[model samples]
Target: MSQPEHDAYAASPRTLEVEDLHVSVGDHLVAVSGVSFQLRRGEAVGLVGESGSGKTLTCRAVLGLLPETGEVDRGSIVLGESDDRVDLIAAGRTVWDRVRGSRIGAVFQDPGSYLNPGITVGRQLVEQLRVRGGLGRTEARERAVGLFTEVGLHDPAGVFQLYPHQLSGGMLQRVLIAIAISCEPELLIADEATTALDVVIQAEILELVARLRRDHELSLLLVTHDLAVVAETCDRILVMYGGEIVESGPTEQVLTDPRHPYTRALLAVATIGDWTRRTLDVIPGQPPSAGEEMPGCRFAPRCRYATQACVSAPVVTTEIGPGRSARCVRLDELDTEPGAVLVQDRIEATA
Candidate 1:
């Protein structure tokens, strides 16, 4: 894919800063707690964990599309830098109307669901172009076709007239991507965007995202449960569990020398480059329920190295290395070298 012309919006720094964000559902259930991360301009960050880990909630919180029963209880989600920054949590409808789609674009898992079934996909993109891009009808139509082409769609003009259901999964996703980047948003949040597709399609989507990020200089917050996906596409990784980030660092560093037990466990089970068929290792215990209170580390119950110290008091997130942090009471005790025995291997060896 070729790089598009640099627009005024692309010149500004678009940094997504989420600080101590807490999301609450219903009256008292805190679905996300103390979750924080930053995505700088032209950077790709992956938020990875098993389901029920509040990844979607965090994404929703940033997008201001949380369910009616859910709201940000505390913390701030600021976009942009310096005088141009806007706190999404405090922003009202007017601010949100200007921010979403225009400033920050998102592509979710179900592309068909987000699109209007009755409207032709091309017309959908055209509407966004006209409304958000402030282009005339003719100009919007031309730009929409160009966007479809930019996203690598075949027969872009022909595909424009098809409804959501008329397209294949990969094609629909591409259409969604066309709409997402049509406004030239600086930040793109892809929440499980490739989860529903097959392996080949998934790889295509990841490559497309990477290309778009490079061409557009767009910051990416890719939310997924697959570490392999992060390993391939993201520059940094945030390993989330039970509503909080358990470990975060440069992708290569964390994958090779994981400081947190939960991260190691995830790496052990992940099918990254190991093509040899074998029994898949599984994390021994279930993730804690949303808003489930725990005395110490959230993953202590499942961690093989956990002891009384790990459960007696809340584990504080500590900096283990440059730009690397993990929430574990036993971080010092654990081996942080590459090829270290994983917790799962230890369990299997004993069993």
Candidate 2:
């Protein structure tokens, strides 16, 4: 069957548009190339990919936390607001200092790595609350305690006094989340925020986030590879491959009826429908190094349907819905299925 064209995205009351964005790691490496998407208020958008697909980098760019070596080349992050469309990329440090943690909060992959081992957990939360969230010292401390309880922590006062090294990975993660969401920012970026936690903790965290977003009318940009997380938490999905978006649409649409070739393989491997009948599912080929420039579709080397057309086809997305799109050569003929042979059976190749 032919795939639906991009005009099919569901209607939403509010939106955050990211248009033609680019991120560079240095003089030569461009991590993400002209990426774009819309995130609605009180909704979740998942950018799905492996580590180097530029998911984290894109999130950091939004929060003004990109590494010194990394830079946002050009783009528009149109955050819906009462007045003034905030220009994140062109904003000054003073503007960023005001916006970063106050208007935008980030829950990164490693909470332990970010939390200061020397400081007590309570002190860190209180300080951030006072400085960014705009509470007095006493009020911030109380708010900190409130956040712990909100996140399902017991003995919140005792956990506050605990040092980073004294807590388990899950505890530290929850504490970090409390700090991130303490201010109730309009946007939240969760870059594998649940990675270190066990299954129970992960599920709890996801639920907590979903609840909070709905209650507070928050927008979330979730970067995760776990397909289940996408199914449960996100309304829409953006599939990233080799520093560009390969496919995106409503989560269900993209999952059940994928359009792009890369999207097809991802859905095949992740679909819950009939995985029981197949052996292990995997996508073949090591991703290309962004350090070197390549032409055409980046996933073409691994895509089963690739022909010569993909070799030089500049990466571009065809519209399938209001906010759904993808960069694939054979969008019309794409099919979601298990490969004839194991994707693993093939040798590693790059486009």
Q: Write the per-residue lDDT of candidate 2 for residues 114-195, one digit (tens) a residue.
A: 9999999999999999888779988999999989888778899999899999998788888888888888788888999887
lDDT: which candidate is best? 1
| Off by more than 4 A, model 2 | 1-15, 271-280, 336-351
Worst 10 residues of 2 by lDDT: 342-351
Candidate 2 whole-model C-alpha lDDT, 0 to 1: 0.79
Top candidate (TM-score): 1
Q: What C-alpha lDDT values do all the predictions have? A: 0.87, 0.79
Residue pairs clashing in model 2 are 5-320, 6-319, 6-320, 6-321, 7-320, 7-321, 7-322, 8-321, 8-322, 9-322
How far in Å is the alpha carbon of 96 misplaced in model 1?
A: 1.8
Cα distance off (Å), candidate 2, residue 220: 1.0
Q: Could you tell me every candidate's TM-score relative to the true structure?
A: 0.91, 0.88
Candidate 1 per-residue lDDT over residues 201-309, each given as its tens digit: 9999999999999999999999998877887899889999999999998887787677888898888887666545388779998999877889888888898888999
